[model samples]
Structures are given as structure tokens and as C-alpha cells.
Target chain A: MKKIIQFIVLAFVLLPGVARAQEAAGSINDMWSFPVVYAYDEEVTWFFDLSTTTFAAESDVYLWIWSPSEPDAGNWENSSEFAKLTYEGDMIWSFTLTPTEYFNMTPEDIAASAGFWFRLKDLTGSLQSEVHSMAYTDYSSFAGSGELWRSYPSSPLIDEGVSILFNANLAEGFEDATSIHFHSGLNFWDIAVEYQSWIPEVVEKTQLKNMGGGIYKMDLIPQEYYEAPDGYVMENIAFLFVKDDWAGTTADQVLYAGEFIPPPPPVFTFFPQQISKKDFLGIIRTNNEPGINTLIYTVTAGTVEVTGEITGGVSEIKGFVNLVSALQNVDVTEIHVLVKDNTDRTISDTTIPLKQLD
Target chain B: MRSKIIYGLAIMGLIAVGCNDPDDGSYVDPVTIYEKMDGDWGLMSLNMVDEYAKANAIEPSEQNMGAYFNYEDFKIRFSVDDNMEPTTYEVMGDVPPLFPANGYWKLSSAFQQPNGEAVKIYLYSDAQKTQMTDELKLVAVPGSGEQMELQLVRKSGGIAFVSYSFKLNAVN
Candidate 1:
């Protein structure tokens, strides 16, 4: 009887602690669904950035969604295997689902309700992330817009997903095309994923999803879709939409990759516009690169030579040398100055004429 | 009538006492620039200026050189005789010789020039003060703050081009 009483006491003490631990660790940092735009019945993969949460990397994560509908209701403590998310490396997790199938609702029902809202959790609901919602992109307006093609994020990065919508009604020969395939390449055909209709896998992989009513969509993550080699820099994607195994095709098209603006160049200049042998010479450089913090300099006037170094960070490096004492009574019209960085890269080597003092 | 005469004499005596000059005490000798300048001075800042660039309105015409070549530890001392007259001057730190390190020194004027002309410190290489080495303009006289500024100008063809200004503070 005493053992039973002690067991009850321990259960009371530890149960609440376990309940508290089941609460959300943190909110998702970011959430996005591939195909940026999709129909309610179309398959899409929703990605979550869990880096900001307490969820361990590459851990088993499951979805517990409620609004639109909760197909896995009454099972929060033991999420179904179908709701399990695949762990993408780098603390990112993804779940691929068709809204209509996952919610067990009609397209009209899913669209009429509030968007996808859910918290990510581990099996048995012991640990979870804060509630988050996946963003939806509606592309229905492009049907009547009379545009041939449009992409969901006008510029796309190589590793991110991009959705390209096509208006077949506007194309000359796409009306009777049983299917459409993407024959694309990176950097103007430097690397290509050819649409070989003979290969069943290649044909299916390059096929576009027909959205009915002369509208179609092609979704891809450039890096994976092209199977580019390591360190492959994608400048632009060049391609055309082919119809029914070369029965017809659209004009050649190119989508330029996002622009990367490099940092401004470094600038070197002498402090004083004019100098004399009896004045201190100032060396200054601004907008330097990282780790280029020091400048070593050598100045020669007649038989006298002076050398020293100045140190600073990425913004600027500046110093002054005492020429008055070093070149006292020395006869010279100009002094040769050589400056190099800490890495021994020559920054400047030139002879500056000394201004005759009056 | 005798009472009136006594009152009148008292009034005149009181007037004479009030008219007498107030005692201002004896006169003391005025302080000279030599007395204020004769001491050990530590360098506070040393600036090199491009006078030609400044004349032409160019940017970055001046730079501070106090941190270079051991100038942070630089010191100068001026000695005077018991009469408070200028005698010898010496640079104390192991720094580059911007001027004659040790020399007999004298002021261009015993007192500040009333005409506003800058007084000069003339350095001589000999005790007899026959050979002149360098001259530095006393740009700022030592004031109540115990600080002074000296400028050495380099010139050619009677026009100044570059100059060095040394600002110093009394050590003790």
C-alpha cells in the first residue's frame, strides 16, 4: 500500500513536467511552399526553417494542422505516419502533400476555409514548434491576362524553387499538345537537362502540369532540376516549352538569374594634395577588403630612406611618416614612395614631386 | 563766532583727508615670457601642414605626427640664468633630429612684441651664439594654462610652402 501511494505521488510530480515539455519550443523562423502557386488539388512541398527552434537537426518531425481541416485530429499525441515530414539537412524540414487529399476536402471547401495553419511536432507530441501557416500564391488571374508566360518571383536563385506559368491559348501550336516538356540549360546551354522523350523517366521529369483551360505550370529548384556539378554558377536559364514529343514548341526563352552586386572597390590616395621635404607624408586607403588591415610603406628621398607600417580595418588604413627629420638638408626634387598591404600586394609605387617651399 | 570757526576747520580737514590718494602699495616687477618659457615641456601634439596645399585650397593639408618615431616620449627643456634670461635648450628624447638637438638659445625679444609680430626662438650651435642654426616662431606664448605652441616654417623664394607646429605642455 505504501509503494502504491509513493507511485501516485511520483506520477503527480512528473506528469505536469512532461506536459510542460510538450509545449512549443519556438516558432518557425520561415515557411514557404514550392510551386509558389498551386491548385488546391496539386501536390506541393512546404519547407520550414527550424533553425531558430529548439528542434534538433535532422530529427523526426510531423505536421499537426487544424484549419482548413485536421485529417489527423484526435491523434495529436500520436501523429499518423503519413503526416511525418522528411528532414532536409540544415535544420530544414519539408512535407509534400496535396491540399485536397491531406485535408480530405473538396477544392471549393479548402479554398473557402482559412489557409493551412499548423505546428510541427515530434511523434507522441512530446516536443513541438509554435503555430505557423504556409503562404499561398494564387495564379488564377494569369489565365485572362493575355500573357504568354510569367514566373512567380521574377528573379530566382539556383537553390530556391521557381514556378513558371504558361498560357497555351496564346501560343501558336500548344492547343493540341498532349503534353509539354522543358528542355533547359544553365548559362546558355553550358549545362543542360535535355527532354529525351524516349526515356520514360526523363519525359515525366520534364513534363509540365496542365492546369486545365489552356493554362500550365512548370515548377523546379534549378540546382536539383539540372543536376549541376558542384560549384556550378548559374547565370541564366535558356529553354523552350516543347509540346507532344517535338510535335510543336514555343519560341526560345531565357530567364536571367538574380543579380549579385559585388562590394565597392578600394580607393588609395595621399592625404595632402601637395607636400614638401620638411612635411610629414600621409598615406591613406579606404574601402579595403577584409583582413587587409595593415599597410607597409617605404619612401626614398635622395640618400635618406624611411619605412613603417599603419594598421586599420576594412574601412580605412592611414598613417603619417616624418619626412622633415629624415630629409633634412637633403637635395631632392621628388621622393619615390612604395606602399604594400600586409599580404605583400603592392598598392602604389610612384615618385611624387616635392613642392618647393617659399 | 568761535564755534562757527571750529566747524569750518573741521570740514576743511575732512575734505583734505578724502582728497589724499589711496595707498596702492609698492610696485612689483612684471613677468616676462622667458620666466614662463624656462622649463621642461612634454610634447602634446605635432602637426605637419602643407602650406602650399592650404594656399591652393586643397583637402587634407594637415596631418598629426605625434604618434610616430617616438614622438610620444619627446621632451624639450629650456634653461635660464639666475637673472631669468634665456640660456641653453636641449631635446631630451631619442627622437629624430627635426632641429638642432642641443644649442644655445635666445629670444628675438625679451618681451612680447606690442606690434603683434611673432617672437622667435633662435637656436645657435655655439655658446657664443655666433652661428645660427634654426629659428622657430613662438606662435603661442605660455599662458595661465601652462601650454605653448611653436611653428617651424620652411620656405623658398620668400614664400612659405610647408610648416610643422609643435604644441607642448609644461611637465612640472
Candidate 2:
């Protein structure tokens, strides 16, 4: 019995060592974090693209990080269920954790450490991926940038997390405020997340995290925070920093969404190098603005008047008007053309001289 | 003997002249524009040009509309009688009716115009080809590659405004 007990103890100690010795299937193709930047105390998800690795799709993946402090230190051979990553499909896995809470270390310690260093492994700790480190965005320099407001990513997408840092010291009427809140909207208030002081949830959701010395940060995924409808195109976020239930508010601020490139201006024109009264006149407009699909045209020649509409999408709207029939017997020297888009915006109003056909 | 040698040289010269004759013993009838444009033609591309934009030197004076409005399946068949006279023209596909879909058609000239004037294809709604419906210009005659370009121009007063250029390939 004594020998058996000693053998069992030896097996328990050697089993982990053997499991740790198992080779990783392959290295992960890539890894990144949403928000791209986050504070140590904030919750962030580390995504691992395991497509290049031999890891099975949607397989159970667990974190085995060490630097910035390891939370699951003794749970390598049998990782805790909490350490298991959530499979995000396409051979990708994500582990969402607040660095401070996961490591049981202060934000300062996490910052001072060598960042997020880890390898991903299976439950048995046999199949693993190569070691990787998640880099931290050091926003410590923002304190001296002297800007009133700065977004972690200068331009932010609607669905991703964005950290908006505000320097209350730069704004007036924000001094001695108990709390700061974000009152914002997308596309110049086309959609809004109003800071309703009466609603407890709204009050809590809009409150900003005071970073001390009049520096505050508001971290939010714009889509989730605003509950924007499907297919909502976010242009620029119009916002203001409100202090303590609108006791005092800073001036209006705007942060343009990332990749919200404005479409090119619409171009309208008549077709053919030269025209005669006995030809079909073409009307065309390309690079039409959104909601400006149809172009209505009115042509005036002598005493005769003709009107028609050319319809298309954002790319172009083109159609031919039967001028061969419209002006068959009409004698004229020039024709006046007026073109307007579906939005009632006039695109062109001009006169074209006739090229007398011999 | 000298007389005989001169006669032999004259016979050889005649043979050489006969061999060097420029004309081959073959005759090919001239292919008219109607015959080249006959049969089915599939749309290779369709472009809309803005004449006002071009005249003013504006950007994006033309747009390729080949991919729009089921134009990829767009086909036009210009039929001719045994005498090679244009009989009836019909456009295939459920695309926009840029012109009359089917009609009796006749070309302004059976051959390409040589006076720098565009040859027009007159479309008529009546069987007798008297009631005119639309007209399209034969901008490009079918070449060795079985490709042709037809343009429909829109005009007001006497000035050309917009045009649609249809590049087509002969379908086997």
C-alpha cells in the first residue's frame, strides 16, 4: 500500500510534465484584439485565428498566458472551465477577460509587465499553439498631447469598441463635476444615445471613467451603445461631454467614423459628340449620390417641350430620349436642358448648340 | 538557227509574263454591310457617353452599362432575305427598350458610307417599313473579327446630347 501510494503521487507529478512536453500542433496564423486599444482594467477579447494551426474547428481552446501575471498558473494539465475560450467560428477562438481581474494584478502591474504573453492549448494541454504576445496601446502620452478629446483609434468603426478620452481641464464649466457623461448621436443626431438623467441604466451607461486629473474615458461599442438599427451607416458621431446630469456641458464635439469615406460628386452629361434634331438624345449621370437614383430631365427646343426620367442606382442613371421624333419638324438653333435628381436637387441647367447636319 | 533562238526566247518571255500575272484565278463577291451585320449579335459591352461632359472636358464622360439591366444576355438579330436585303431586326433579352424591340429595318445604305457620314439603320413599326419608330447609327462596321459597334444618338434642336454605343460580337 505504501509503494502504491508513492507510485500514485509520482504519476500525478509526472503526468503534468509529460503533458507539458507534448509538441504544439502548429503556430496560429494571427491574433488580435477588438478595440485595438484598451485599458488594463477594461474587458477585452483576445481573438486567435487558428486557421494555420492544426487545431480543430470550434475545438475547446484555453489560455496559458504568463506575463502580465498568470491567473491559471497550476491549471495547465487540466485548465479551469473559466479559462476555456469561446469559439468564434472559422477556426477562431476568443478569450474575453479584464486584465486586472484575470491576473489579479493592478493596472500598473499589467502595464509595467512585458504585456500579454501566452500560448493556447487544449483541455488536456497536449495540443497547443506557438507562443504569442498581445501588444498594449500605451496611451500614457495622451496626457501631454493637450488635446481636448482623443479617440484611441483616431477613426472608429460602429461595431468595434472605441475608447474616447476627454480632457476636462481643456473644456470650460467641467470643473468639480461629480461625474462626466457622454451625450452623443450618429450622423448629426439622426440616431442618438441621449443622456437621460432620470433613467438609472442610461445614467450608468453614459457615465465616464474618471482617470484622475480631469482626464476621463468613455469606452463603448457604438452600435451596441446606440442600439442602431440594421444597415445603419454611421457617418460622424456628434457628441458633447456633459457634467453631472447636465449641470454643465462642454461644447459640441464630433468624431468621424473610420472608413466613412464620402462618395464622389455626381456627374451629369448629354451623350454623343454632336447632335441633330433627328437623333435620340441621351441623358446620363454617373457616380450618383445615395438616394439619388433617378434623374428627371426637361428639354426645351424652339416651342416644343420634352420631359423624361433616367433611372439607375448609385453608379449611374442613363436613358435615351427620342429626339428624332420629338423635334422632327421643329426648327431650332439651341436646346435648353434641365436635369434634377430624385432628391429634387438640380444637377444641371444648360443650353447646347445644335450641329447642323448637312 | 538565230531566228529559231529568238522565237524560243519570245516564247519563254511570254511564259514568264503569264506566270507573273497579278490576278489569281479566283473571284470573291464584295461583302456588304447588311450581310456582315446579318444573323445574331451578342452584346460585348454597352457604354453611355455624355457629350456635354466631353465637350466641357468633364470627368467621367462615359460609363460602361454592359453589366446593367440584363445587358450581358442582350442580343440583336438583323435578318436579311436571300437577296441580302435587310428584312427584320429584333432585340433579344428582357433588357430596357432603348429602342423598338422588334421592327422592320432597313439601312440608309447597304454598304458603309464613304463620305464621312454615319450610315443610319431605320426601324419601322409597319410591315411596309413606312411608319418609322427609331434610328441607330452604324458607328462601326463588322470587321474580320466579327465585331460591330452601333450607336444611338439623342439630339435636341440640332445638337447631339447623349449617345449609347453598343459593342457587339457575331454569335455563331
Please provide, for model 1 over A243-339, each residue's C-alpha lDDT reduced to its tens digit, 9 standing for 90 to 100.
Answer: 9988988899998888644557998988666677766778999888767899999999888888999999888898888787888879999999999
* Superposed model 2: Cα runs more than 4 Å off: A1-57, A88-92, A98-101, A105-112, A138-150, A166-176, A187-190, A211-215, A228-238, A251-260, A266-358, B1-172
Interface RMSD of each: 2.9, 6.7
> Candidate 1 — which residues are off by over 4 angstroms?
A1-63, A68-113, A120-130, A148-267, A287-298, A302-314, A322-330, A338-349, A356-358, B1-22, B66-68, B92-96
* Worst 10-residue lDDT window, candidate 2 chain A: A272-281
What docking grade does candidate 1 earn? acceptable
TM-score winner among the candidates?
1
- What C-alpha RMSD does candidate 1 show over the true interface residues after superposing them? 2.9
CA lDDT of each prediction against the hidden true structure? 0.88, 0.84
Candidate maximizing lDDT: 1
Question: TM-score of candidate 1 restricted to chain B?
Answer: 0.87
